[model samples]
Target: MSNQKDHHYIPQFLLRQWTGEDGRLVRFYKPHATKLMAEWVYPSQVGFEKHLYSTRNPSRRGRNWLENDFLQRVDSMAARSHAKMVQSPVVGLSDAEMSAWSIFVRTLFHRSPSGFKSTQFHSIRIWEETVREIGPRYAQMKGPDDPETIDEYIREGINGAAYDQVLEHFPDTMMSSRVGQFLNNLHHAYLR
Candidate 1:
């Protein structure tokens, strides 16, 4: 017997996309809901936390971890993001919010126990090196800590790091995982 309440965060359609190569849902799925899940997911209709597994499941410990470290960070970033947007025409949220949310989601995906960790940031490091080889002093300038610098570069058409160039020069660093493919595809999507 399974419970639907554990997985109320992720939309069913989005959840369906995470199926394994064996054509079955990954083992991470569950149905537990957090009280604040609605507050976190609010105004958007459904209360969902896409990358989180189950807040109530003891095996996952999602509620404890999120309430402790993850959501705290997102909330802090959201405040800063909201502050920056007050002056910009970027609408909804300025890049601060967008970047913060992106990082939070990406981090959650990285921390996820069963599925989202399938393709992590470390798994795509080769692509960054390959990108450096193609050109763009930004990679060297930003150094090791700031990965979002690449996103900043893409968002800025002023630099030589254009979308077409990234696609054309993307490396073939396949390590027997679709993670390689996802990184390449992510570049394409990230640019847009």
Candidate 2:
């Protein structure tokens, strides 16, 4: 596993575009959970959370796989495409460049702190609904050794390995499907 802990929801490359002559971007935030205020800070310092993208389950790719293996690649590709878009016209972009930009934009909507929380919420809701539907069947088949009630079954089952697997894999799977749909529906055109 990598020692990298801090993960940026907003890629530094995107944030650095707003940097001033002082090499720092103006960050507006609610300080102390009160009124909003602005502070000049490095992009790296402002848009990250410790271990935000770290997965509890360690795979062959390592614990930081999502951050290192996935988001980093997305950011890198988008950075190249963004540079091209800035220097030239959008209509001049190649298919790959447009695809990269589209993927990045879609990713940004789901990778932010709020977006991640919402994804987690939906995943849990789906799991809960599945458990409720299956609970009666499971209870009927369960032996004396099994958990007594549906709630007990849920608590034990969901707090174990199954829960980790669902939480870890579902969001990535959902994002992949959404990206696939976005790419399939995307059309290319140039306006005069």
Q: Output the number of the TM-score-best candidate.
A: 2
Instruction: Name the runs in model 1 displaced over 4 angstroms.
Output: 1-51, 54-63, 89-102, 108-192
Write the residue-wise lDDT of candidate 2 on 23-60 in tens digits: 89888998687699988999889778887767666667
Consecutive 10-residue window with the lowest summed lDDT within model 1: 167-176
Q: Rate the local accuracy (lDDT) of all candidates.
A: 0.39, 0.74
As for model 2, its CA RMSD to the true structure in angstroms is: 3.8
Badly placed stretches (over 4 Å) of model 2 are 32-34, 88-91, 139-150, 156-163, 166-192
Model 1 agreement with the true structure over 44-154: per-residue lDDT tens digits: 224344434323333243333443344445546744654544444544543345655455444444344343324323333444556556466666677565455655543
Q: What C-alpha lDDT, on a 0 to 100 scale, does residue 135 get in candidate 2?
A: 64
How much lDDT does candidate 1 score?
A: 0.39
Best by lDDT: 2
Q: Candidate 1 versus the native: TM-score? A: 0.25
